[model samples]
Target chain A: MEVNHISKSFGSKHVLSDINLTFEDNKIYGLLGRNGAGKSTLLSIMTNRNFADNGEVKIDSEDVSDNDSKLGLMYLMSEVNLYADGWKLTQIMKDSESLYGGFDHQLADHLIQEFGLDVNQKFGKLSTGYNSIFKLILALCLPVRFVLLDEPVLGLDANHRELFYSELIQSYSDNPRTFIISTHLIEEVANIISDVIVLDQGRVILNQPVEDVLAKTHSVVGPQKDVEQYTKGLNVIGHDMMGTIRANYVYGDLDDRILPDTVQLSNFDLQKLFIFLTNQYEGSGKNENK
Target chain B: MEVNHISKSFGSKHVLSDINLTFEDNKIYGLLGRNGAGKSTLLSIMTNRNFADNGEVKIDSEDVSDNDSKLGLMYLMSEVNLYADGWKLTQIMKDSESLYGGFDHQLADHLIQEFGLDVNQKFGKLSTGYNSIFKLILALCLPVRFVLLDEPVLGLDANHRELFYSELIQSYSDNPRTFIISTHLIEEVANIISDVIVLDQGRVILNQPVEDVLAKTHSVVGPQKDVEQYTKGLNVIGHDMMGTIRANYVYGDLDDRILPDTVQLSNFDLQKLFIFLTNQYEGSGKNENK
Candidate 1:
């Protein structure tokens, strides 16, 4: 799937601007951004739920606009509940099968049992966590090449969230397909995602493999003076101070210099990187381009 | 605050069974449980939102039931929104001040600006994340001895959640109060919470200081044969196998003994410990009485 020069605006505010990205098949992509950072907007335009003011979306080199065949290949489980409130969980599953075709009944049944969800229950009566599970079940069972999930684990408990991740990995291994997961729980999804696309103020600020992005950033903690002197010229994104100790998160490559006995250096995870990057953009107007 | 032998049942379903716990002043407690494990029920009973079939809750040896003075000292920021839909943020804060007697308007104003929330906006108009932030601001600002936060970070993003944790630490340092935070995001609250209460199937399975609980369990990984030999007769809570490699998570004390060269050991986090304990109960009917 490809999004070409996608730009969107609501009144005078630009939600997304010239966002060009491509998602290759059979790889998991993490669509990450701060709140109101155009993640949902870009996804909506890609899935054709909302129209973009400029550019277009393509699937298999064909325009997705007004194209049922192309749209059929993609499935987006958004935060908003689109299903009718009157429908039961079982009925919703049947409806999805009828619309998408080849709904994996076996997987659906397995997930329903695993999550301990009552199929007879009404959609409106389900709790917040259960509501998320219901949508996730539908998304997983549907036979779609490209699946885009927005806040998939929004209300899921830790156990359920863990189960969902394992189940997702299981299903992906069984059937390789493109998945674009947009979520606020960065650490939970950090390991599962193959590539990351970070949006900031309607612009693509960072896009790279998870490992590569993590490799460039490091957290060096030690005596305040020594740490500051060591990271003086590095692209320091953020830092924390406690008593006389200091921890500086430095982005970009670090020089192969001898470290002090008291200092300790470790790699920065996705969550820390996202915080520092977005925090930098908000703080000092430092935006990195890909 | 203390809950003595609290038990509740609706029809034949026992929602809470003999839950006796105490919340000391000036400490944070992480109330953790799986779905349907009775976390919400316990919180409701503690806050007097729902009545327990037996036993009572007390503040300083005085029964909280029907005692306005005692109840006023505690507050529950629940998942269910208590504020009216038409009320603005400022109005809600004012209402809270009038009711609670000492709402910190300065702190509330600071939080509102920090989260980029508009006090003029109606409560219903706020987004999911903002709604959580709105409630969190009130929880932090209100001058109460005990605060019960149920899923406080429900719809929060990474940056906002991080901000909330830091602010919580800051406020707790300035004004020490008892905070019982019930949520499924264990890793996020692990470091912040002083103690943990793990409820499972209407029972309090574990309750202890964070450091003590973490010290009791460990995960040892190595070859299947070597790992099994080393962990023989040990309290193995959970184990996973991949080819010839095995990772066994053992609870209770690990003896100081020499291990195989390939075997490695590490601590089990709050989330992993909760999952294993809960899984153990459901799988083997072994409930440790600690």
Candidate 2:
């Protein structure tokens, strides 16, 4: 699937601007961004739930706008509730099967048993965690090639979140497909996603594989003077100071300069890298294409 | 502060049962639990916003019920909105000062500038993340000895959450006070909190310092037979299998047993320990007093 020159605006505000992305086959992508970064807007446009003001979305050279067969190939489990409030879980499942043409009843039953969800309970009466679980069950059991999950574990506890991730991986292994998950919990999904797409101020800032992104970032910790000397002229995105000690986060390759005895270099996690990258944009109030 | 034999029930459903715990002075406690685990109910009862069916809350050996002085020393920042919807940020801060007798206007101003919050906007018009930021500003600036924050970083982004944690640590350092933060995101708070209190099904399952709890847990990874053999006679809580490799999570101290060359041992984080501990209770459907 490809999103070519897509742009969206609300009144005078631009929500998404000339967004271009391509999601390859059978890979999990983490769609990440801060609040109001146009992640949800882009997802809605891609799935045709909302219209883009500019370009188009295509799958296998076929435009997805008003195309029933093309739209049917993708499933988007969003925050909006499309089913009636009075409908039970069973009724919702039946309706999903009818609309999607087929549903994995065996997988649905397994998920229900694992999550301990009551099928007889009404959709509106479920708690926040249960509501998320129900939507997740539907997304996992659908027979679509692409599944887009927006805040999949919104109100889930630690244990439930673990179970959901494990189940998602199991289902993906059984049936290879594309999964694009948008969530605020970056650390939880860092290991699960093979690729990452980050949006900032209605623009795609970073789009690459997880391993490639992590390979170029480093954290150097040492005395203030030594750390600064070693990281001079490099892409020093951010730093933290405590008395005489300092830790500088570098975002590019290390030079061949000999390391100081007082300094120690290590790898940083995705969350820390994300914080520095986004903070740079906000601090400068300017968008620099990467 | 002490919670002595507190119990609460609503329509034959017990929210908290015989809960007893003590909070030492100038410490940060991570109050962890699943949904409907009575964390909010307990905080409300402690702040005199709600009445308990049994027992009482005491500060410095004096009952807090209907005691203005005692209640004044502690502040509860809850999910419920206590201010009028039409009030602006400045008005809310002024009211807080009048009600609490004093407020840190300097700190509040600094936070407002850092977060870029618009003070002229009404309380109801702010977004979810800003709303949380406003409440957090109030909680940090008030001149209270005890502050109970229930999901203080509810909708905050990663950058904001990191900033909040740093400011919290700085505030605690400047003026030593007790902070009881109840949240579902455990890994983020694992390093910031001094101690941990876990509630499972309205019961106090684990109460210990963070280091003490982490000290007793170990993760053993190797072949299935070797891992099981090494963890034999220990409290094995959970295990994960990836093809032939198996990882067993042990809760108690490791015995002085010989290990195979292929086996590896390492310390697990707080989130893993919480998952294993909580899962043990749910899998058995029986509560054993620890």
Pick out the ten consecutive residues of candidate 2 chain A with the lowest summed lDDT: A281-290
lDDT per model vs. reference? 0.88, 0.89
CA deviation > 4 Å runs, candidate 1: A255-263, A280-290, B255-262, B280-290
DockQ, candidate 1, comes to 0.47
Residue-wise lDDT of candidate 1 within A1-290, one digit each (tens)? 88999999999999999999999999999999998999998988998899999999998899999999899998999877889897888888888888888799888888887888899999989988899999999999999999999999877877788879988998899999999999999999999999999998899999999989989988999998999888888898888777788888888998887788888999978998998888633443212110
Point out the worst 10-residue segment of candidate 1 chain A by lDDT: A281-290
Residue-level lDDT tens digits of model 1 in B1-290: 99999999999999899999989989999999987889989888887888999999999999998888988998899878899898988888888999999988777876776788888999889888899999999999999999999999987888889889988988898789999999888999999999999998899999999999999888989998889989998999887767677888998898876788999999879898888888633443222210
What TM-score do all the candidates reach, one by one?
0.94, 0.95
Clashing pairs in 1: none
TM-score of 2: 0.95
Query: What DockQ does each prediction reach against the true complex?
Result: 0.47, 0.50
**Candidate 2 deviant stretches above 4 angstroms:** A280-290, B258-262, B280-290
Candidate 1 accuracy as TM-score: 0.94
